[model samples]
Target: MDCMFKKIAKQGGDIQFDDVETIIGPSVKLEGEFQSKGNVMVSGVLIGKLETSENVRIETNAQIEGDITAREAIIAGNVHGNIIIAQHLSLLSSAKITGDITAGSIAIQQGAQMNGKCSMVATVEPKPADVKQNAASVMQDTTELL
Candidate 1:
């Protein structure tokens, strides 16, 4: 295991890929969506979505041009679309992301550059009742001030 994987695993992430089922090498350039049930390691360029039930690792030289959905993700490259991780998302110093992120939890290194909104999956959804109650409370406060 590399230092990056070790760090992610230590942080309670699902990034242990002892049995990687998919590997996109650095020289490879793929298009279209990629889906898998097991661990995926990408060191190439992918021009479409990536969906996996297990961990997805994007290496330093890798680049992804579309969204990513995974159980967990460790990114050390460039990503141009949204990322949704069910467990955790770790962005290394070399990572550069340009889209929104929704994750259970996230860790970003000092030099990582991310330019989008980030929301925790557990808190992103607003309950209808809460919204209605908030609106009612605001209306009541306004009426009292008038």
Candidate 2:
């Protein structure tokens, strides 16, 4: 908490977190799944899944190449995977993302570059086909007719 300790693998650092804020140092590389119950800030290279019960922030110059799921996310980096945010998603000016995204709300900055599908909704419902098949069975009244 004093000097902001950096991750060991990188000379600079990979990720940083505190009671309220989290920072991912520049250019550091991480090769594994990451899960957090609090907010997270990424400013390095991550090659795995990222999940957070709280908000996730990806700063400029960061690169994440895996699935990300969170309550909210702010991306200013480069991501090459699917993202599912339960609450909100923000793409800042320097962000470059190439993956599908689903969130309750979304914002993309002027200079951001995203090449993927995006969906906005409070909750994700099952596909219509999946639901329709079940409906057909429910209408079967063989027992009642007998």
Clashing pairs in 1: none
What C-alpha RMSD separates each model from the true structure? Answer: 8.1, 8.5
Error of 1 at 124 (Å): 8.2
Residues 29-92 of candidate 1: C-alpha lDDT, one tens digit per residue: 9999899999899999999999998999999999999999988888999999999888788999
List where candidate 1 sits over 4 angstroms from the true fold. 1-7, 123-146
Name the 10 consecutive residues with the lowest summed lDDT in model 1.
1-10
TM-score (C-alpha, index-matched) for candidate 2: 0.70
Q: What TM-score, over all chains together, does every model reach?
A: 0.78, 0.70
Q: Which residue segments of model 2 deviate by more than 4 Å?
A: 1-18, 124-146
Q: Give lDDT: candidate 2, residue 83.
A: 91
- State the C-alpha lDDT per candidate: 0.87, 0.76
